[model samples]
Target: MDKNKNHVSIWCIVSLTSIPLIMTLGNSMLIPVLPILEDKVGITSFQSSMIITSYSVAAIFLIPVAGYLSDRFGRKVVILPSLILALIGGLIAGFASWKMDDPYTMIIIGRIIQGIGAAGAMPIVLPLVGDLYQDDDEKISSTLGIIETSNTFGKVLSPILGSVFAAILWFLPFFSISALSLISIALIFFFVKVPKDKDEPLKFKQFIRNTKEVFKDEGRWLYTVFLNGVLVMLILFSMLFFLSENLEKVHDIKGIKKGFVLAIPLLLLCISSYISGRKIKGDLSRIKKIIVVSLIAMSISIVFVGYTSKKLILLLIVTSIVGIAIGALLPALDTIITDNIRKELRGTVSSFYSSARFIGVAAGPPIMSLVMKNYLNISYITAGILGLILLLFVFKFIKVDEIGKSKEPA
Candidate 1:
């Protein structure tokens, strides 16, 4: 850690933290509102689905480019402008929905634009946190935990917020995206100070070479964490979606009551993330153990859900265990990547990490939809097997020095 670095204020943390929170809310909040969009715009369900698909596809493709840009320029430079773009996207969508007789095309366009901005905003944050606390694994891990918690909190809050805003005005959630982005933009502009770049800038070719070399040497564990990010998100979201569907279909839970029930597991994730991050405190061995336990617990509990799912109370108990596992595991994965990667390469590598996570997040629902429509127990087992595969990689390859020296990719 830089001994001379300025003391970080709560505002700086809030500013940075708000990016992911806003990003999550900006996208996920639109899910519940999709039904509303379909009705308001006189659009088919497929057209409304396009509104989400446009944003995610755009973000996934552009994230790597955004990371490199942040690597070339600076984190705040990439973030502030991206926030403005999102703000514009939100306004465009909100306006189209409000005034236009035919607004579907315009709303899709706005979401695509917002997706473009999203590619640059939240994904770079892991590396930015790495830059801010170089060599201080404890702070990086804890702060990353906080950021992850904010993200999970946003997911937990999305349905309720969307419902609340839509109750007043169907188009209000669209504008809410802009409102939140504005707050993030202002907070970042006023408070967040990225560490001054000290390394001589790498030429593009050299940057490519450096990135390739990083994978060549550290691909074993790096890919593990990357895969870790994917599987954790994949399992988490898929289970949550399944749980949501089961609640509404089987138990007749809907509206805010359904939202509150969903919150149970997600809140567990938030709490587990906060506490495990503090406890792990840069201990890679401890991180590994946590990952192993989380994976096993998630697999077992989810499989149990296949049998117990018809019972609402028992189902929540089991899935909440999965939530706790995910909460403890993700910070561990974040620490392994952030603490090990060199600061110069942090943006590029962590961008890949974020892209993997986004893919997992994107795939979860469709995967859940497919699986739940068929033989459900078999699907749960398949998801569990995917987790165990990740566990195998962790046991074999995730070794780091106990003395705090990183095996940086040369």
Candidate 2:
């Protein structure tokens, strides 16, 4: 091992990690603040929900394109600009909430910008890490683990921080997010070194040609695994929304208390993520089995959360289980995908992967909200059924031995 290979300084790793933290904090912070925003901005629940959706919506549209661009133009170019965009989005949203006294539309616009920025920032980071550590799979996986840990850690603390901020001012949370973005922007410029791909840069027409070539022989297992990642993201988003709303209303928890309850699953997720990343299987077949188990665990945990009543302890257990599944699922599944894709198109593949996830993020809460309103038990049932279907799809559609066996042609 090159001493410098594993020696991505803790500071550099942390800086890389901070990209997700900044992105996820923007997400998790808003969960606890939604109800408060409903009151303060005088919008209906659905409109408030749009604040979350806007980010994902933009991500869904932009991530793949950004990924393609990054693949051709370079990751640093995409990433640095995206961080700046994130900072600007934070400013717009924070100021709109703080000084404008306007409806949430401005905030939505800001979130849209944040989402666009995130397209470049979040998805690109993984490929950049891949570029940096091309020869060391374990180190790459560990780097991914640290990046994810930061992401989940931000999620863990964000709601609590948001609630505490809400106690003082409704806009404080957005301001906090803005500050993090500013810091992230500075860090990226100072530390991150983008690696250049040696292949001929792809153009629009040639990119499509390459994409088609890959699709012609795309592994079936990759699609199944990709969909599973999507479902996991959806379930997690739904859980956050449901718990945040339930703690606030039924449990009469407010401010930091509400945030604390919301953070429970996130804290559990952080711990699970660390353990999961270290224990990842390099063999694709074994990884598939782990994915199946994680999916079932995720379904069971989510269903349990819906059936349980006001007992916080029971909810915590359920959330922790869900966290465990997620912790295992993300890195393992990601490695599976990365291992299959040619290094030349790593950014494009990763962007598509992220796009799938963002679609889930956009759909999860609103769909769950609609289901919960129609039939209180439907949310968990729906999530569980989806998980089961996902599991079955993996079994039926994908050959276990086929994944990660050959590099995808591009």
Candidate 3:
């Protein structure tokens, strides 16, 4: 470990925090703007959503590869190039959204590039934290907790900020995402200085073997559960997406007020994340139970949100519950994955979880949008079913108790 390292540098947190901010801000901010694209670009609802899906699609296919590469080459090596790609991708997307008359195709292409870049950034970050503070167990745990908060904070704040920015100009969110990526690049280049791993150079065949090895761990099931938890999260977001679209198309909301309505749930998320961060010192069983209950609440919230579309107060209350559930679930999932996986392999495993999440995010919107377009009830029904499936799998798969065994001695 580099004892010379300043563990709590503001620049380092800014850089680390930027990873989630960039990944999240674009998505949340774009929700309000989607309607604008639909109105202006004269595209189908599915095509309009393609702008969101395109990035997740790339991330779904690419994050594991990026994670693997990050583990092999060096954390900085993968992260730096990714930040550059994100900047370029965001710039192109922003410009295309500005200039092109038929911008969906161009925006989708840009988003794919951006997603590729984000795949490189997001999954590697937590593991990079793990790597950076390899010797300090308490610090690792605390840093992991902080990263989790930052991740949720990004989700909570991004849409509101995006809304504020979008109120200024529709294209402002894109430029904001580009700027955050650039700042992340600068932070990593200067402040975060983890020594490179000196493990045997990873060959392609060995990479495949290592991928398989992660699943062989008994605790790996917990990570899979975390993946499902994220999928449940995507289901919640899908509900939000459908709800926002309905508000606009059915309720005639436009612009910043539309953004505010959509962001109400995230306010709850922010509050819950702060609470969960304070309560991070408990035992594994307690944490696992918290996750399970949160998942159940999230499912119930989705059902209520769907069922109460005509009842705005009911919708807001349920959406807030969904947010609270998300706020608690994500940090626990991050800690679970980080604490369970070995240090050397943390990035790769984290990537796999991220890929699972991207797969969910990529698939959820289009599928949910198609259902709601025809049979809106089916959308809530799907969310309910996904939640139940996760419950069943959580019981069957996750070994929450034993994961602590892998932790290095303090």
The C-alpha lDDT values of all candidates are 0.81, 0.80, 0.73
**Top lDDT prediction, candidate number:** 1
In model 3, the runs with Cα more than 4 Å from the true position are 1-6, 135-137, 196-207, 219-223, 404-410
Worst 10 residues of 2 by lDDT: 401-410
The residue-by-residue lDDT of candidate 3 on 1-410, one tens digit each, is 36655256767866787787677876666776777667777887788778888988888788878887877788888988988888888888888878988777778887888898988987888788777666565566566667767776776676567667777877677778888888888888998777656677568786567556556554457565656656755775676678668777777876767777777787678667656655655346756776788878877667766677777778778778878888877766776676666765678778877887777777767776788756776677677778877877777777765564544322
lDDT, candidate 2, 1-410, per-residue tens? 56665356666777888899999988778988999998999987677778888988998999998999888888878988898888788788889988886747889999999999889899988887778877577777777777777878888988888888888988877778778888987888888765555678877897777766665556466677679878888888877887877887778887788888778778888887877667663555666777788889988778888677478788788888998889778877777666566666778987888899888889877876676655657777778898989989877866655544435441
Instruction: Rate residue 84 of model 2 by lDDT.
Output: 82
Poorly placed runs, candidate 1 (over 4 Å) = 1-3, 34-52, 100-105, 402-410
* Worst ten in a row by lDDT for model 3: 401-410
Clashing pairs in 2: none
Local accuracy of candidate 1 as per-residue lDDT tens digits, 107-193: 889998998888899988888888877677788888888888888788778777876788789899899999999999999999988
Backbone clash tally for model 3? 0
lDDT of 3: 0.73
